[model samples]
Target: MRAASEILAVWHAFDDFPMETLTKAWHYRSGNEPKQRSVELMRLHRERYGSSGNCFDLALWLIDAFRREGISAYAVGHDLLTPNAHVAVAALDGRGRAYLCDLGDQWIEPILIDAGSGDFTEEPLAGFVSGARVALSVRDSWLHVVYLRPNGKRSEQTYDLRPIAPDALLAAGEYSQRLLRKPLVERRIYTETEVLHWELGDDASYLSGKRGRTEEEPMRSLADRVERIHRHTGMDRQVIEQALTVYGTASIQFD
Candidate 1:
């Protein structure tokens, strides 16, 4: 029973979001214009969770929060044998337009896919999850990350694929079947200056450098990052519309 206020409180504590983005998000909720910047959302989420929030827990908290708010969403189970506990959110309006939103990357923008094809109108900043192939596409807004398994001659499939750690996924191929039983997904997000190492199950941990150093000033706060992302890409009205189109579907409608 996660409350929306509890979630917001977390965002407030960590100071994850910049003041402007935080202000804008609230505006979107209140029928005002929302800004374009994933870092703002990320920072806001961090502030909400304080220090206790990790990637998986934050995801779980979001699921519970969405359910409480009467929103529709699901966590893609990993496999038939064992499923990943990670979750992604989806909502649809009466017009048949659906939105699938995930806070798993630097691009805070909700990706717009055709629901039937695994194609993207705007490609994500990150690469595809590999080693294990999972398909999560739907006619509605809910897209799944699917994995296939051989059933007799043919194959049976499952839709819950969590983000795999790049190294573990690659290593799993070389290891014995017994040793490869554990799931591995790369839970990382790379910005211009920082590479956040998310826990295997948690997606929203504090960002750190990958190798030598990470850029500090640009990412010091969520506001700075949001402004930077906007400046770098020159977020236009079209991008804003796309994001609104996705979030606007969150409203409830009756038949």
Candidate 2:
């Protein structure tokens, strides 16, 4: 079991790691590389790029990280067999509570997923998805999350709280590691007023926050886009360059 404060200490460190966009390309040697690398590699790429992998990668990394500290941890996911599947980590805080640590979604901090605990709060928690007051609840074997945005709109999702087996987690991770859709990169920027989400891809990019979303023109030159991505994501220039080269450019998207 782990302590919430202990998990926070670990997450405080991981909070600096960016959610990477180039893992799939790096694994396939699709970028400006010579040959395909091992598809199962995660740690090497994390350090090589100075960031963490996507959702699955982040979950797996956190699980191992908690274990290294002698804490119990596991992976939980929903829609695992679908293209929209998402995964996150669940670590037991020895006190019989579990915290939902979702760095992939750029959560500012982990939130208590155990609603039965005396410390649980129904008040919406901010930063679980950045710029939103995320309300969490556990009932009927499911964890429900509601995102209250600054704008007059809200979105909801249900997370199956059951811990998934290691083999299933690995299988889903490998499948995701091999699937390359676009050169997508994400980063959460903190400011005195609010948190802004920067979402970038080969075809499109945007900075979203309390005021509103500002869509940037599609970057035509690969060099320019790579530089811009680096400025936002803190990924190495060479890595971003290679990833864009493999992903190529696409028509600008409006959505």
Candidate 3:
């Protein structure tokens, strides 16, 4: 297994990276290029315009980072039957111990899961600790995750531990970005430190911090909306501009 320190370092590096869900409509309208490799995705993130993608893109990027550091890492995802099929990174340390490293979910650090470990709950990530519990369990050969909210609420997801080849992972991401009906994408939901929801032809709603304090701002011009989103998300201004442009022209509607 790799050193825990190394895993923690990688987690810190990307802990605050923005996570965005762009609809296929936005993707096609922006004329954005298709994703094929982790390196390509990283380059897009580093560009003057920032990059935003689904969980697959985020997980692949983290897996790539671990590989670059000589740690054994792979992309893991659940099958379609799961409630919210998701992707994350499974990294093996030098000692062959595996840990779950999830950046797309904004985890504070890597979670340790011993082989055949049964269900359990752990404290929230460092910066996000609010007496909430992150529970992990194995069921139906898939990793089940539940984020227990402080208010007795729970958000759930699952990931298949079977390692997905890089090529296959890329294909899956492309397919999701192209053909999948992603409600988050449809609603133009994006979150980093806060949750942002914006729908075409409607006012934008922003939930600042974990307290869920929400504020609604009237939709000004598309340019104004882009600026507002960039300000709150700290995403690349250019990327937000392009995405908003696509949002406007695509005439995307919510279900």
Candidate 4:
């Protein structure tokens, strides 16, 4: 069992707070790599406070920390086809046999959760003095969770969890170091949201235009924009740009 301090440390490392620091870290640039907004947030945190790990860094550290705490954790790669990002440790027994003890897995840690998948499950990760029912969903084969906050506002979180041998991680790590060259495909980031998968990259597709929107107002807004563009548009290019300016670049093309 991890001590209170260690658990708190893990929480502190992962909590998405102090937007300024997080902004820099999220946007930090390395060499010729493109700017990542999250890196900016992280860099700000590192500069002002000292050390703060991004989701990937946090997972790696968590695996190491769990190992220190006597858990035989191993890292695993996610899906081969999808974005399939993130990593976590596998549970190993005394005889070195590994089962699906993905408790420490970062992408789908909730699966390791002790409670049943029902109405009254206690979720310590809910971050509330009192836990709430965190709903789960899938998109592009990725899993996600939705829940209400203390203020009654709702939000969602995404992640992946994988099961593999310790040797698999060592091999994957070595392969990346030796062979793979693409940064986006190479460096694993712990963005495990099912929604994000449908919204990222060239193949991104929306189940509907309303995949991300939860209410009618936004949906109507989308409808209104599309109607206006259809009724009186100089060209699709201009309409698309107008949509981009209002709803974002993805909104224009995601159908």
TM-score for model 4? 0.33
Give the TM-scores of the predictions, in the order they appear: 0.31, 0.85, 0.73, 0.33
**Candidate 4 lDDT over residue span 104-163, tens digit each:** 222222222211323223332332211233555544434455655444557665544444
Q: What's the number of clashes in each of the models?
A: 26, 0, 8, 32
lDDT of each: 0.32, 0.73, 0.58, 0.33
lDDT-best of 2 and 3: 2
lDDT-superior candidate, 1 or 4: 4
1-255, model 1: which lDDT tens digit per residue? 012343333322322311111222222344432222133443453455212122233344445555565554444323212222223333332233334444432213233334543344332222222112223454342344443322212222233333334333323211211121221222334466543432221112232232422333433443443344334333333333333343335443210
Local accuracy of candidate 2 as per-residue lDDT tens digits, 12-36: 7776666765855655554433122
Candidate 4, superposed: residue stretches over 4 Å from native: 1-49, 74-144, 150-160, 164-255
Best by lDDT: 2
**What are the C-alpha RMSDs, in order, of all predicted structures?**
18.7, 4.4, 5.4, 13.6
Clashing pairs in 2: none
Ordered from best to worst lDDT, the candidate numbers read 2, 3, 4, 1
TM-score of 3: 0.73
